[model samples]
Target: MSCKVIDTHSQLAYVVRMIHCVCNNINTAKVDAAAARGAESAACVQRACGTKFNCGQCREDINHRLAAWRALNPMLEAAE
Candidate 1:
């Protein structure tokens, strides 16, 4: 008998703290923070927060969320 085993990547098992802006269960807060930290990359936030890009379909919303978050976190931006 032969058995094949599959492992889940640590990077992929991330759940961001998102709020459903459209009531579609989309986490915006997390996306925004991640974007501010990494922008297009988002990898840094992904690693730190363990939030996978599961919502690729929500790119537009993500962008919007990022902008809103930046506006809210002006001090964070200046510090960075």
Candidate 2:
């Protein structure tokens, strides 16, 4: 017999979706997708996500997400 074990905790961490923009219901996945699609600024990310800043509190978080995305995608940053 063979047994397999799954690390749900670690797997859940990767699958977890964080709400970065409460005003527009934007999540980290959306932000990353926008970044992957050439969104260099928060405004670009908002536009790509089909929404705009309302309260504006999420701007900084969006920027952070963009920065993290850029870090992961160094080639995109180098090309820019």
Candidate 3:
């Protein structure tokens, strides 16, 4: 038998809080933080989080999280 965990942030398995880069122990929260701070691209997120590409598996996931973060915090800039 097998069981799967669901994150409260999303019904989808790809929620950003899930680990995105095992190589650097980077999760969606870190990526989203970077995006919230104006890191516009995946490379920016990587740089902000002090992580590097290892297996290249996380690039797409990071990008997805970045977009979501931007959408969630669109008003963040106005408060700054």
Candidate 4:
């Protein structure tokens, strides 16, 4: 039998699915789109994605993704 080794610390193992606002059927793609379209804040994301103020569980997570996405793609920011 051949021995196979798996890397527990691999980056793929740490990959996380971005699910923002499940109640409103929103996902990472939607959030990214919104962020790219000038959603610099969670409130803006909620509004743009029609999430509104539901259970409020996704609020923090959305904000986090927004900040990260913006940091990575600085050019997506809308001109003020």
Q: lDDT of each prediction vs. the true structure?
A: 0.54, 0.85, 0.76, 0.74
Q: Please list the residue runs of candidate 3 whose C-alpha ends up more than 4 Å from where it truly belongs after superposition.
A: 1-16, 77-80
lDDT of 2 by residue, 1-80 (tens): 99998766744533568999999999989988998889988899899988989999999988988887787779977886
Specify the poorest-scoring 10-residue window by lDDT in model 2.
7-16
Better structure of 1 and 4 per TM-score: 4
lDDT of 1 by residue, 6-80 (tens): 776533323445563333344655566566675643344444356555645554655555666666667887777
Q: Every model's Cα RMSD, please?
A: 13.9, 5.4, 7.7, 6.3
TM-score of each: 0.43, 0.74, 0.70, 0.68
The TM-score that candidate 1 achieves is: 0.43
List ranges where model 1 is wrong by over 4 Å. 1-26, 32-55
Task: Give the best candidate by TM-score.
Answer: 2
For model 2, name the residue pairs that clash. Answer: none
Candidate 4: lDDT of 4? 96
- Tens digits of lDDT, candidate 4, 1-80: 99999867544322455577877877777778888788877778888977686888888988888877766666655443
Candidate 4 all-Cα RMSD:
6.3
Rank by lDDT (best first) = 2, 3, 4, 1
Pitting candidate 1 against candidate 4, the one with the higher lDDT is 4
